[model samples]
Target: MAKLDLKTADVPKTREDARPPDGSAPIPIHSRARFSGWFGYVVLVLFAIISLGPIWIAVKTALSDSGTLFTSASSLLPQHPTLFNFERVIGLVNPADPRLQQTSFGKVDFYLALKNSVAFTLLAVVPQIAFSAMAAYAFARLRFYGRRVIFFLFLAATMIPSVVLFIPNFILIKDLGWLNTYQGMAAPYALMTPFAVFFLRQMFLSTPRELEESALIDGACYFTIFFRIVLPVHRSALATLSMLAAMNAWNDFFWPFLVGRDRSVQVMAVAINSFRAQQAGGTPDWSGLMACTVLGIIPVAVLLIFFGRKVVESLQYTGFR
Candidate 1:
């Protein structure tokens, strides 16, 4: 038997000192918040107020009478609050059956614009999420040639200004004869965004690899692992992403404005502008414009409210598991 040298004796590792025998990185220590005192709360309150100020103003102005908005533009509160602007903006929207649009005040009724917005937004969001999740799974789990280089390219794409793509994208739309079409508004956004892929990739990395390995041993394939395990696990993250994409699609202006030639497929954002422009064919209706803007924000705001906590939780998902 060989005797161990005293100088070369191995020391036993405690939980804290143990390193992975496989040479993988150690799991991090995730400490609970060492939260600050009242100062923290005060700071958060101040920040919230500052953030909500513009929204509050918009809502207030939307509620205010047009005469008041014109006469007393600086007033913080609506002295004589009314829903005339909202009512006008919601023209011909039937309470019993809301799908169909009828004519009353505006060129394009609100319900039709809303349906178009939903259609466009869904087109952009659903496929983007599906493909982004797949790409993200590949990035996080699969080992393939040029993976690093390809992912680097994807990361690098996000850094380029979107404005740079506008002209080229417009030309492509023009060439494809998709200009002023709903498909045109939806097509450019249907693919995976670099950030969405990146975001979901990071979340995927956080998921337990052991789960996948176990699934594989159970004769489950990649698709099964992705759909059953990965997607269900990261639903909060997906909701946050979907909400973000939907909001962008819903509130999108420049692209919709550029491509939207008529009211047939008009989204809320473009319709609001055209509505405002037509209303202001002579003089600008500031109250109506504000009201339209406020109305446009409601769906996104409601989504945030419902999923806000989940979004916050998912932000912490990328932290230590």
Candidate 2:
């Protein structure tokens, strides 16, 4: 035993004192991280400019007076913006030339075409989504004879190009006497999109089966589980499917053009093509064409803006995740 020296003895301090003064906190110095952050922002800005620059030019072109459009000094900022082009494009102008075709613009039925496109989209999209959803649910959850084989067949069918079926589809429509009608335009295109079913089926399958099992234990039928649980949980998938279906139906040109022999049933794409052809009689009205193109893009833009996130999330949930 050592003798106690009480007056000059050292004592152990608390554990807090064991830590360094600047303990795990790191101080960010002026370095590569800051530079990288600034660089990333700059790159983003440049990318945005590159992406949207043409769209801005289109807007400027659409707003400029039709006469001044061909002039060289039409900068990104229009020297003079006028609604005349929009008016002419929308058929608000009544031309004094009767011998010329009666058009909303000087030569195009832009409004009618837009209307037809909207109608076709509306008529086709709802049934497509509903039918696809039901089919997907059955394939995903229901155990039936030949279920796997049938699904395999559907998957195989998706590999076949729509263009290959065009002739037979056309003949069927013609036989049904649905030529140049809205029903004919929408019907053949709307039924049982294999890709849509496949997409939704994957989503439905990814959902935990425990929920469906619980529902079944409670005496809830398959339809009840689908409607109450599956649909609600997979709303994102539905939105994505609906948006894609609508886009396909709306932008469809070749099929509609071939089937819609009459002007009354012609979609916007066909109408736009017809407008381009008619306007280019001797000289192309690039301004009017640009205006029509802008108008045509608006609906799709709106749909994307509203439903794009859902579509992306749904796609992720369905497969990518």
Candidate 3:
């Protein structure tokens, strides 16, 4: 063997020795990392602006006077930035005021519509979530004959266009004499949706079976295990599903419009549309319209804001993962 020089065999190279032959200083690792971080933040900021632009415009329009909107259509900030539109939309404005007469103000039973929306959302979401969770548990945990086949069939229902089912559902609701009623409004959505079952089943499937086995050893029944063990452990999943179902129920228009058009049961969405249609001057009440839009959006926005992290965590740990 050749004589080995141990003195400098594995000595680390100096910065200068590691430099390229062109004599340019190599970029520091920290500098590159910082640049990448900044680039990512810039991209996120740009996307945020793009996503929020229309919402901001709607807010701006909602706050502006109707005439000012026409006069300064390009303005980013609302002219005079008044709450008159919001007050008018929410029925806080005096009905006899000259200002109220000029626009579609105080003509809408917005509070009633808001109440109906809340009621419909509750009716739709509570039963749907409860039934869907039970179905998901059965699909995920119970081993019965044809379970897989039934689940696959449920999955198949998702592929069917929702519009294709509407006529049949409408007929069913009408035949049940549920027209213009909260029950009719909720009929299509009050029970388990295929998607809800599928979503909860995935989470249930991912849950460790050891807990259930332990519960079984302690003489716990299926319902006991499901309610005490599984449901308690998946609170985040349940909350996420509830928020999604609530948002969907809150925003639903077409079904409610078709089956619940009476003023007593009109939802916020249909009410907003009717408000727009009832304007006197043949001109759209852009300010009132946008104000109604914002009001209708507020509850959903608040739900997302408060429970948004739970939603993300549920998706990350269960379905998406």
Candidate 4:
């Protein structure tokens, strides 16, 4: 006799008991996921607005007419926008006229200060990059006496406040007859930046040892390996360092003011202060001042915008590896 089919008997029947009485549709997982994504985007948009609102306001104010800006209330958008303020403050309005201070446009002296800043940056950054890279290479690759001690000394320099060194630096510059000269303003502080050495040393240390070892086997010198191999691989670090150096040089006011008394040697930041004092007889031209500030910041902003990704990526890579 054939055995009874027990598996078919155990199967549940699709009768009244198996069915839900309400007959309501179940919620879709995709719909819930879509709602979460939209919520995340909304939060991001709000954060972006919060972060960018102030910068937008400043730009709007800078673009607005000076008369309207002073008389009118604060606004996200200017009622009557104009480029005259920027033109005036950036020296596009009046190319000549030494005594003719352009309240709407910036002074020619401002441009001169910009030139001085560029010169100082170039003079300082080249040597600083070279020396720092060399020091970092030696620290990372070479086996030398007192290496740890020397590196520690360099690291210790970071703890010392820059203000404490100002007086001594002034005395040295005075003795060298470099006061009021570009050398006095840029040189003393340029090479002594321990941060550069430290940063570059870390980058060098993070490089694969086998690459350098291979280069050595191929009869390449340390400098050859560094210049030919390491530098190319770490272009991001170089870009970041260059941008930092340039920004520091351009924005340096206190040291330049102390060392460079001569109007000819004054940098843009120093010149802007002098302009404010001279222009504001009783009331400061907030519009013009803001305009100049905006102009002065453009180069740095542009640099960062273009190279910021590289800077961030390099830092992240250095940190991780």
Candidate 5:
């Protein structure tokens, strides 16, 4: 008699025979086209109205002139729609007289601030994700001394309020002579964040180890495996992290204001503040302020519109893991 390799055995299963070991009936498949109920639809409709009502009001006000916006706050539609506010806030077009209220308010150069925002976001996010993936890979796969202790310290750091580190970061940046520079704005954030490292570590751990072992047998190094194999498999996590990093950098006010006070280097939030500071008299450029707010909102809004579904999938996958 020949000995058999049970490890390599293939077992065939039948649908009717796929019952639970306790012999409970198999779950029945139901049509996904069934209605979720009128109550569910009513709740969703109410949620949509609650979410979109404020945004519609903002858009309406942004399109109207200051005279109309202040007087007709409750108007469902703009009585008069114009790009005067947008052109004013952007500082690209000037009214006939530079002394005019709108033109004076317009001189803030929001376009430059927007450019700086894009550059800083890219510079910070790219290296941040790269470093995070490397750190996460080490934590999830490599066997090293004091790994648990070091990881615990990283987790502990997240518990401390970020506000607590502001003074220390400001002092360190000042000591390094990095104030008012783009490098100063981007450098501090261009490292692995604890949350990012933890999230990616969870993702890396869930990936199959056999793929890495196969690469090792073919004389591939860790870098090759990481770059060619691991990252490609986790693009969902990468996309999700990239979106999160972009959101943080895009909406950031305090840190950017602290380190980048220069006119040429100011981000969107600081630029908007400077624009508002000039409203010393007159009707107040509510339209221009609203337009700037709208401008600040567009990039992230578009990002969510295009990549929202993928990011949601990544979240679900992470939660399931």
Candidate 6:
């Protein structure tokens, strides 16, 4: 019943014929898409530059020589790039040098601060991760009375500004005689934070129930299931949480400044402040300061660089719900 349109089938459509029947110019969709893609790339590059500029400046300053820094401060690259600044920060600089004696590098005690920072981070991160994971499991898998109400209350606690809690928390810590102690510095953060709890809870909720059920059938306790089944399945998520917690603990300034002012317990952040103060009424050891900052950043930077993919993969599966 069909008549074959052989002539039309053989003929190629011209650009004009490719236009819609109404006969306005066809949209240059491919060109528009290309333009949009280029625009997005430009925006991303711009944001990257903005985000990384300061860090680049810090590195540049750190690499610069102290004597030549003022002369070449405006230059992008260090005029005389040297490791002397780094050596100075680490206290390997020759003390016999007159220039070294004039500065406050002796008072900075960077190694002590570094040790304290590592200690504080460990004390905060280990207990926090352990407690947060257990609490998340309870919220996600176990049934108990007032669970919803208690969980909501925990969520509500996140809405409360941290600054508002500082006074009460400070008074409590002071009353407990935790000032200038590593324990005092770590105590506030050692328990579960709402964000960590909420993060792990979402992950736990997403895990397949079948494995947990099977484990229970084998006469496994909740602890066994959590330790043997759940934790191994979500190791990436736990690593992500640890990295985040480490960064937070390392960079914290105000609280550590309040509670851990003594040199023995001072962290890297407070050490920077003390370094600046020791150089007061004089030209700051700009190179040394920047070097110290770079050293402080290296550990976390190395962690992120190595475990960055795990962090991204874990975050990819995280649901807003």
**Worst window of 10 by summed lDDT in candidate 1:** 1-10
Which parts of model 4 are misplaced by more than 4 Å?
A: 1-47, 95-108, 311-321
The better candidate by lDDT, 1 or 4, is 1
Each prediction's TM-score against the native?
0.73, 0.79, 0.83, 0.76, 0.81, 0.83
Ranking by TM-score: 6, 3, 5, 2, 4, 1
The global C-alpha lDDT for each of the candidates, from Candidate 1 onward, is 0.76, 0.76, 0.82, 0.73, 0.77, 0.83
Q: Taking the tens digit of each residue's C-alpha lDDT, what string does model 1 give over 164-237? A: 88889989998999987888988888988887899899988987799889999999999999999999999978
Provide the lDDT at 2 for model 1.
Answer: 21
How accurate locally is residue 60 in candidate 5, as Cα lDDT from 0 to 100?
Answer: 78
lDDT of 2 by residue, 63-172 (tens): 77666766834477665787766777787767654522432334677778878888898888888888889999999988899998999999899677778888999999
In the range 1-321, model 5's lDDT, one tens digit per residue, is 012221212221344544557878864422221222334556679899999887777777788866676578878888778776777667656556443544335456778999988888888888999999999999998889999999999999988777788789988999999998888888877997787899899989988899998999999999999999889989977878877777677778888988888889998898888777767465446677778888887875786798787766654533210
Q: Count of backbone clashes for each model?
A: 0, 1, 0, 4, 0, 0
lDDT of 3 by residue, 106-180 (tens): 367779999999999999999999999999999999999999999999999988887789899999999999999
**Runs in model 1 with CA error above 4 Å?**
1-50, 71-76, 93-108, 279-282, 311-321
The TM-score of predicted model 4 comes to 0.76
Candidate 2 displacement at residue 76 in angstroms:
1.5
Worst 10 contiguous positions by lDDT, candidate 2: 1-10
Instruction: Evaluate candidate 3 by giving its C-alpha RMSD to the native, one decimal.
Output: 8.8
Q: Candidate 6 residues 160-183, lDDT tens each?
A: 877788888888999999999988
What global local distance difference test value does model 5 have? Answer: 0.77
Instruction: Quote the positional error of residue 164 for candidate 5 in Å.
Output: 0.9
Residue 274 accuracy (lDDT) in model 3: 88
The alpha-carbon RMSD values of the candidates against the true structure, listed in the order shown, are 13.3, 11.9, 8.8, 11.8, 10.8, 8.8
Against the true structure, whose lDDT is highest? 6
Q: Of models 4 and 5, which has the larger lDDT?
A: 5
